[model samples]
Target: MPSTLFGFTITDHKKVFAIALPMILSNIAAPMLGLVDTAIIGHLPDAIYLSAVAIGAMVVSFIYLLAVFLRMATTGYIAQSFGADNLAEQRQHFNHGLTLAIGLGIAIAIASPWIIDFSLWVVQPDAALIPYASTYIGIRLWSAPAALTILIALGVLLGRQQSGRAMWLAIITNAVNVMMDLVLIIGLDLNVAGAAWASLIADYVTALVGIYWCAKALNWTPALLKIIPDKLSQYLNVNGNIFIRSLVLQLCMATMTGYAARYGSDIVAVNAVLMQFLMLISLGLDGIAYSVEALAGAAKGQQQPERIRYWCKLTLVWSCIFAVFYSLIFWLFGAQIIGLITDLPEIINKAENYLPWIILLPLVGHWSYWFDGVYIGLSLSKGMRNTMILAAGFGFLPLWWAGMPLQNHGLWLALSGFLLMRGLFQALWLRLRWRQVV
Candidate 1:
C-alpha cells in the first residue's frame, strides 16, 4: 500500500503507472492505427506499391537508427540534471541536444540520396520497383531534420517525466498521418508516394508540436549556452558506444531477415507477422523501462542509493506482471491474435506453430529492458554496448550457425537465447561494479 519494496518506501510506485499506462494504452491502439496503414496499402490494386513502401521504410529506419543517440543521451543527461535540480545543466543539455539533432538530421537529408540508391542497388529487388522505392525514399529523407528534432523533444519531455505530453505528441502525428493517408491515398490516388507524403507532413507537424512542448517544458533562457568541449567529449563517448550497439543490432536483424527469406515466401510472411507481435511487446515493456530511466535516474542524481534500488525493484515488479499478462494472452489466444493480421489458413497455421517462442520471449527478454533503464539512469552506456556486442557476436551468431539445419525454428532459438544473454551479462556487470558507477 505504501509502494514499499522490502522495507524501503518507493515514495512513488503509482507514478510508475502514471508514466507507463499512457504508453501501454498507446501500444494497444497503435496496432489498430498500423492496420489502417496496412489496409490502405492492401487495397491498392498494384502490389508493387506495398513492396516499394516497405523497402523504403526499412532502409530509412535502419539508417536513421544511427541518430538514436540524440534521444537516449538527452534522456540520460536531462533526467540526471532534473534530479540534481541543476536547471542550467538541463538547459545546456537541451540546447546542445537540439543543435546536434538538427545538424545530424540535415546531414542525412542532404547526403543520403546516394546512400539510399546504393543500398537499394545492392539489394536489387526488381527493375519495376526501383523508381517507386526511390521516389518514396527521396521524399521521406527531406523530413529527416524535422523527424530527428522531434526525437530530441520527446527525449527532453520524457526525461522531465512529461510522458503524457509525449504520448499526445505521438497521437497527434499519427492522427494527422492517417487523415493524410485518407486524403492523398484514397481520395487523390497518390498511391505509394501518398503513404510517404502522409508521414512527411505528419513529421513536420509533430515536429512543430514537439518544439512547442520542449520550449515550454524546458523553457529555454534568453541567452543560449554553449556546449563545453569536455562535456561534448563525454557525451559523444556515450553516444558513440550506443551507435555501436545499434549497428550490431540492426545487422543481426537484417541477417535474420535475409535467412528467413531463404526458407520460402510463407515463412518470410510468418516471420513478418510475428515481428509485429514482438514490436507490440517491446512497446508495452518500454513504458516501464522509461519509468525506470526517469525515477531511478533521479534517485541516482540525488545521491539516494536506497531510492535507486527501490525504484529498480518496483519497476521490475510491474514489468514482470505485464510480461506475464502478455505471455498468457499470446498463449491462450495466440491463434486468434494471429488471425487479426491475415485470414490465410496457411500463414495463420505457420505463425501459431512458432507462437510458443513469442510467449517465452518476454519472460526471458524482460530482464534486459529493465536493466537497460538502470544503466541509462547512471548514464553508463558502455556496459550496454559491450554486453550487446557479446550477445550478438557470442550468443546469437554461434547458436544461429549451429541451428542452421533447423532453419526458421533455429533462427527463433538463437534470437531468444541472444536476448537472454544480454540480460544476464548486464545483470552480472551491474552486480559486480555497481558501487563504482553509482
Candidate 2:
C-alpha cells in the first residue's frame, strides 16, 4: 500500500505521472513541428523567409488558439462525467464536442481570407515578406477543419485518462509533419508554401487517426450524434467563457509579434526563436497541467475536495521543480539552441542577446499554466476569463505601451511582465477561491 497525505497517496503521484509523462512527450513533440519549420526556412538566403513563416504561423496559431475552447471544454466536461461513472453523459459530451469542433473549423476555413488580411494588417510585416506569409496562410487555412477535429479528439482522450492514445496521436501527427516538411521544403524545393502543405496534410492525417481511435474507444455510433439543444446550449455556455479567455491571450501574443515586426526582420526572427523556447517551457509544464486538469476534474465529480487540494499542492511543487530545470537548461545551452534553429548569424546573435528573458520565463510563467489547468478542471471558466482579461487589459497593454521607447528590448520587457502578472493574479484568485473552486 502507498503512503497517504491529506488524501493524496504515493499512488496519486504515480497516477499523475502516468497521465503527465505521456502528455509531456506529446506536448514536446507538438513544438517540433515549429522547430523543424523554423530550421527549414531559417537556412534561406534572406532572413525575410524566416520572418514570413513566423508571421504566417503566428497568424494561423492565433486563429486556432481562439477556438481552443473546443479542447479545454471537452476535456473538463468529459473528465467530470468519467469520474462520475456516467457513460451516457461521456458519450453525450464527446458528441457535442466533436460537432462543435467540425462546425467551428468549417466556419474558420470560410473566414480565412478575412482573418489573414486582418492579421497581416495588425502584424504589419515587411512589404516584401507579405506575399510569402500570405501564401503560407492561404494553404494552411485549409487544414482548419482537420486540425480542430484533432483538438476535440485529443481532449476526449485526455478527459478519459487515455493518455497513451493521446500521446500516439501527437507523435504520429508531428512525425508525419516533420518528414513531410523535409520532403516538401527541402526535397521539393518549394520553400514556405511547401511547409504549409506539409502542415495541411499532417493535420488531416492526425484527424483521421484521432477520429478512428475515438470511435473505437467510445464504441461510437452514428445514431449517438443527434445533438440535443439543451446539452449544446450548456456546452456553448462553458466554451463561450473559455473562448473570450483564449482570445485575450492570443491578442497579447499577436500584439507582441506585431511589435517585434515593427523593429525589423532581424528582431522578428530572433523573437520567433525565443518564442519557441517559451513554447517548449509552456508545453513541458502543460504536461503536468493536463494531468491536473483530468485528475482535478474527476475529483470534483467525486466531490473529493481534499484530493483536489492535494493535487494542487503536488502540481505546484512539480511545476516549480520543472521551472528551475528549464531555466538552468536555457542558461547553460541557450547559444547552442539558437544556433540549431537558424544558420543566420545575425538572428543567432540577436537571440543570444535576449536569452536571459527566455531563461526567466519558466519561473515567471509556470504558475499561470498551473492555475489554468485547475480552473479548467473545475469548470471555472468565468473566473479564468476574468483573470486573463484583467491581466491583458490592465497589466500587459500598459506595460507594452510604456516600453515602446525601448524598441525590441521594451517589447520583451513588456512580454515578460505580462507573463509574470498573469501568474501572480491567477495565483491570488486561486488562493482566495480555493475552497469554492476545489
Candidate 3:
C-alpha cells in the first residue's frame, strides 16, 4: 500500500502529481523561448540589438500572455464538459476557442502598425532603438494568430488532463524557437529583426503542433460548431472578465517594473534578476494549479462538492510544503543563482540586499497562484476579477504610494501585500459565497 499524508494515501495524491510533474518542467522550460532569444541576441556586436529585442519581446509576450484567459476560460468549460462525459461539448469548446483565436490574431496583425507606434511612443525608446524595435515588433505581431491558437489548444489538452501532451507541446515549441533563433538571428545575420522572425516562425510552427496534438488527442467526434451567436456572447462575457483580471495583474507587474526603473538603472537591473526568480517560482506553482483546475472542474461536473473540498485542502497542504522548500533553496543559493545571470559586481551586491524579498516571496505569495487554479476551474472569473482589483487597486497601489519613501523595499512590501491579499480575498469569497455564486 502507498503511504498516506493528511488523511489520504499517496495513491490519491498521485492524481495530482500525474499532472503536475510534467507541467512543472514544462512551465520551467517556457521561459527558455524568451531567454534563448535574449541570449542569442546578447552575442550580437551592438548592445542596441539586445535592448531592441528586449523591448520588442516584452510587448509581444505581454499580449500573448494577457490572452491566456482564452486558456483559462476554455479549460473551465472543457473540464466541466469532460466531467459530464460529453465529448461533443468538449469538441465544440475546442472549436469555438480556435475560431476565436484565429479571428483575434488576424485582427491584431492588421492593427500592428498602430500598436507599434503607440507602444513606442509610450516607451520612448532611445531614438536610435526605435527603428530596430519597430522592425522587431512589426514582424513579431504577425504571429499573434498562431500564438493565441497555442493557448487555446493547450487549454483543451490540460482541461482533459492530457498534461503530458501539453508538456511535450510546450517543450517542442521552445525547442523550435531556439532552433529558429540560431538560423535566422545568427545564420542569416538579421540582428534583432532576425530574432523577431524566429519567434514569428516558431509560433506558427507551434500552432501547427497544437493543431496536431488536438487532432491526435481527441477521439475524432464528428461534429461541427457554428460559433453560435448566443454561445459567443457567453464566451465573451466570461472571458471579458478574465481579460480585465489579466489586465489588472499585468498592470500591477508593469507598475513594479516602472518603480524599479525610477529607482535607477542598478535597481532596475537588480529587480530584473530578482524577477526571474519570482517568475520561476510562480511558474512552478502554476504547474500544481493546473492539476487543481482540472480536478476541481471534474469534481464540479460530477456534482461532488466533497471531491472539490478534498482537492483544495490537499493542494493547500502541498503548496505549503513547497513554500518551505522554496525558502530553503533560495536562502542557501540565491547569490549563486544571481551570479549565473549576470557578472556585474554592482548588480550582484544590490541583488543581495533584496534577496530576502525573493526568499520571502514564495512563502507569502504562492497561495494566490495555487488558488487561481481553483477559481479558474470553477469558472469563477468574477471572483478572480474582483479580488485582483481589490488587491492591486486598493491594497497594492495605496501601499506602494505610502511606502515609496522606502524605495525598492517599499515596492517589495507593497508587492508582498498585494500577493498575500489576492489569495486571502479569494479564499474568503470562495468559502463564504462559493455555493451562492457558482
Q: What are the per-model C-alpha RMSD values against the true structure?
A: 2.1, 3.4, 1.8
Question: Model 3: how far is 428 from its true place, Å?
Answer: 1.1
Output the better candidate (2/3) by lDDT: 3
Q: Which residues of candidate 1, in runs, are more than 4 Å off?
A: 1-11, 221-225
Reference-based lDDT, residue 369, model 2: 88
Per-residue accuracy of model 1 over 1-438 as CA lDDT, tens digit each: 666654545657668878777767766665668678878887899999999988888777776777787777788888888899987888888877777777888888897779777979878889899898998888888889988888788778878888888788878777888899999999999998899999899989999988888777767753664777777778778888888887887778878888999999999999988997788788879899889988888887788888788888888888898789889988998889899988999999999889999999989888888888888777878988999999897889998999899999999998898889989889888889988877
Give TM per candidate: 0.94, 0.86, 0.95
Candidate 3 yields a Cα-based lDDT of: 0.87
Question: Tens-digit lDDT track for model 3 on 1-438?
Answer: 679988877986898888888899888787766576578989999999999988988888898888999999999888888788888777778878988999999999999999999999988999999999999999999999999999998899888999998898888878887898899888999888888887788889888888877866665433554567788788878888999999999998899889788889999989889988886687668878998899888888777888888888888788887888888889999999999999999999999998888999999888998889999888898889999998897779998999899999999988989999998898888989877644
The residue-level lDDT of candidate 2 at 44 comes to 76
* Predicted structure 3, TM vs. truth: 0.95
C-alpha local distance difference test of each model: 0.84, 0.86, 0.87
**How far out, in Å, is residue 285 in model 2?**
0.5
Q: Which parts of model 3 have CA positions greater than 4 angstroms off?
A: 220-223
Best by lDDT: 3
Clashing pairs in 1: none
